[model samples]
Target: MPHNLTKQPRRRHPQRSQYGLTLVELLVGIAIGLLLIVGATSLFLSNLDASRRLLLEARLNQNLRSAAELITRDLRRASYWDQAVPKMGSVDNNPHQGITLDGTSDISYQFDAPAGAASAAGFALTDDYRIRMTIGQTTQDLTDPAVAKVISFNIIESKNKIDIGMQKIPAATPNTECLTERRYDITIEAEAPSDANVKRRLETAVRVRNDRVGNCS
Candidate 1:
């Protein structure tokens, strides 16, 4: 028999293959995670700044309303039971007036009243003294260290605004109602925080409830 070598069946060997992520892929995944975290953090911080500004706006609005209403309440009762109205005119500016609606102004509410009952039955009536207070501006700079400043006061003149009025009350004695009613106007100009260009204004017409009838002194 020809020694033809019995060909041995070729043995099949499984090929060894490389597996798992490459170094490049691992580095890419880490980079992507870092990017995501940075983006998310940026968005959150921006939202927080916006919310703070809104809250600031709301508080400013409330403060303005409070100042307006408080002043009006006192003026509404002007002239009391009597119908005598008050005189309206701007005098020299004062910072403590507390009647101005604008952040800056100095003005006073003036009216005549009986000095006392000294001349009660006499021809001359009350001896009224003029009262004046300054209206100043209160400003806070949200930037920097967040400081507040009081700007100039008593800046506007009396003729710059509309005047309010009421009918004069008839003066009487003994049985007199003792109280008079007066009406007048106070003009206010406000400035909004954002866009310093936006202006918010408020004008209050008020009267003292117990306005006196003429000079009683």
Candidate 2:
């Protein structure tokens, strides 16, 4: 018996296909990532700028307030005199009872020093748009130019008459002497040197403690 060997064909297994992204899909993904990064960077920059602006505005306000306070405090002490001095009748004939203004931005006044002598003090606006404070021979800037600029400084004086009852010498004449109450209105306007849009204005009224008795004319 001759055995015939029959060769059967080997079974072929189909290979699994590899999956990958197309060129259009890859480009679209990259574009989306870039857009997200750009948006984040822009948001950070905007917030940073806003913070800086707020800080600058606060500094500007502080500077302006300080300058205004200095001016008002000094002006209140314009006619201050020593209480130790002997009273010359009922009239306050103190020579340091007047405030002088140079018709512009300069104002000067005298006050009694600790040693019982008169001292000169003044506040002025310089050409460089800053407030300068002068005490005797010493001078200093009240406001920093880097922080703020003084746009205008003004001091207005007003007077009112009040009756002082009987005169010192009732026998000489029956006329009643009147006293003049002096008051000043101070106004200061300032702005940030770095940004003109940031500005502040302050106004204050001050009354002299010492009254001056005179003709009141």
Candidate 3:
């Protein structure tokens, strides 16, 4: 009797919960992740290239400056004949000039006296020679001055060179006299064989001190 009063429960189908992502949503998320990765990679590569170029430029400048210093120092002291009397020597069949450049890149000049002891002023020429600069290897000699350290030496002689005259000097100037000196427009260049980009050149004007007064009249 009790069971007959209770109503019977009806069976019903269970509803499926929609919780998973759609195929399109999954594909979009993957595409966005790929873009982020690609952007990061591109930025990294760009920075790397810039850093490499800066390093290369620095190397080139350093090499160039070092080479220039070496050349200028010697050139300024070119043809420095000490206080001793000048005695000309025969250089390659040419007159014993203070500075000698024989068409080629080879240059020889006298800084000290030809045959005499060292001078007290420390500016005297000794043993009839000073130094010579050339394109080839450094010449090692006790009788001669040291060779120049450079890759190439090119001399450009300007016809309208400025001649430092007596009027240019002060009234009491002692050794600052030059009648008509030789003016040399020189270009010194050097390069690293390993890297073609690492090359440098420098141009400077050098006046021969011994050639200043032009045979002292």
Candidate 4:
């Protein structure tokens, strides 16, 4: 037999490569990634809200306490007339004329101003401060635009001892000999302008040192 010129075709194997993701697999992976992102975002928002609330609470408490302490100190010194001095009155052009015992929403009282004192030492009944205490021993406008807001400030006065739970009894008899006793129920409400929910209320009693005392001469 005559040999065929054409050689038999050699057998060849086709190589297989990795296949790409199917449509269903790609969609499932995208869905999982979205869920993770959503969860992370929610967690971050929750933490942020909690932190803001805490900061607001702290600010409210601080403002309330500071205002309370200052008011209390002033009340204790109310009507402080040196050991022997005529009671504050219309005479001598005395600006501070004892504590106003009316059930007013605000309180106004006069305290002895040290010799050579700049202005009379006193707090206006209105939250609008027309007078302020300075570290340099000076006075300034209390109602200045920069002043903080006082939502509510009230001074309730009582004579002798009242059994009311809101009362604060004095260590000594309010009135001794020629002295008269004046008890004060102080209530204050404060909040920042930005946040109404964050607020504070404080109530306390203070006894005036020389409310209506007289010299026994």
Candidate 5:
């Protein structure tokens, strides 16, 4: 009993753990953040792709409209006056306008009749009045009737239907150039061989002027 010599052992306080994240926990949080960033980036890229397609379509439409307007304006006035160029293909072998679908199949504009005496077949004058456009590329000509669409052929005389084919029109005959005096309604189709099936169609009308009356004899 040495004055309670067996003093109670000193009471030890419980040690507290450090209140902070471990290295492993930090690495896991970083990984989660990276995943969120990648997800957001993917969404942005997808929207960009869609925007590009829409812009391309709009541009194409704009080009088509402008070109069509210009051509129709000229075509509608093809037979405007007497001082005008001869209404035969020979007089103005040059085409006024061209229609194309994707710039591939080209259809050009020409007065329906043999423009003049010099105009020949395969590019010749025919009694069958027809506004023709060469549909595809030609190694040689602008009026070679190639699967041409007749716009507004007025070859009807007393129940006789005028032929619109290349062989129908006459060369340098009488002054009654019937094709020029005749007004026609025409439609040209352009297609993309790759889904080109009638993708676009340009339509218009024109009357040939300075036409020799009664056509070639």
Candidate 6:
């Protein structure tokens, strides 16, 4: 039995199959990756453009509102008189009651100063399409021309009157008294200088606080 073990044949194990991607499969995977990257980049760029457009629109709106507010505030102070209480019966007593509009682009008015002096002020649209404010000898630009372009500035004036019949006069004579109220409607349209498509329009009404009273002669 020991002599027979000298020539025994050895058993061999089978080789395992190696797994790997083929050339075609590798190229398909690379193409798919590139497509995904391109899609993501496109989406990001779209979102960025939308954000920039929104910001421009917001800025245009803000500029329009600010210009409107300034005009309304200053116009409200028109016809203010420190001695209005004593001169209520006279139509030509208040010197600061001259509010005039030239065509549709220029508006001017007068107001009583803190020291009881009359001050002249006006707002005008320049040839370059910008809003300019003139108060006394000083001139300034209300809106930044680089940021926005003013398209139009329009003003409409309206008046209302109330009649108080048979009022006792200071001299013991009966008189017919009438009260006149004045108001103005302002419209401002503007657009972003960088982007003409971004635009805004604002409309507001301002009523004069100081009423004018006179005998309905």
Compared with the true structure, all predictions reach lDDT values of 0.38, 0.80, 0.48, 0.57, 0.39, 0.83
Question: How well is each residue in 74-135 modelled by candidate 3, as lDDT tens digits?
Answer: 55555455542543221121122445565634455544334533211111112323223342
lDDT by residue for model 6 (17-68), tens: 8578889999999999999999999999999988987998888788778888
**Model 6, stretches more than 4 Å misplaced?**
1-23, 90-92, 164-177, 214-217
Top candidate on lDDT is: 6
Over 4 Å off, model 1: 1-16, 77-104, 110-217
Question: Which sections of candidate 3 miss by over 4 Å?
Answer: 1-21, 84-96, 102-106, 113-153, 159-178, 188-201, 215-217
lDDT per residue as tens, model 4, 21-86: 889999999999999999999999999987877786676666656666776787676655553355
Q: Give the distance in Å from residue 214's predicted Cα in candidate 3 to where it truly belongs.
A: 3.4
For model 1, what is the error of residue 34's alpha carbon versus the real structure, in angstroms, after optimal superposition? 1.4
Worst 10 residues of 2 by lDDT: 83-92
Residue by residue across 1-217, what tens digits does model 5's lDDT show? 7867878878998887868899999999999999999999898888886675455444433434444454445444332333234554444433422211222222234333334422111121132322232322432322213222222222211112242333223554424333324443444443322232224455555443323223333
What C-alpha lDDT, on a 0 to 100 scale, does residue 179 get in candidate 5?
32
Preferred candidate (lDDT higher): 2 or 5: 2
Model 3 residue 112 CA deviation in Å: 2.3
Candidate structures ordered by TM-score, highest first: 6, 2, 4, 3, 1, 5
TM-score preference between candidates 4 and 6, better one:
6
TM-score of each: 0.42, 0.79, 0.52, 0.62, 0.38, 0.80
- lDDT tens digits, residues 1-217, model 2? 3345565667998886857888999999999999999999999999998887788778877887787788878877886778526865644467787778887578899889888788899999998989899988999898889988889988788889898774655347556667888887888888888888778887877787776665433
lDDT-wise, the better of 2 and 4 is 2
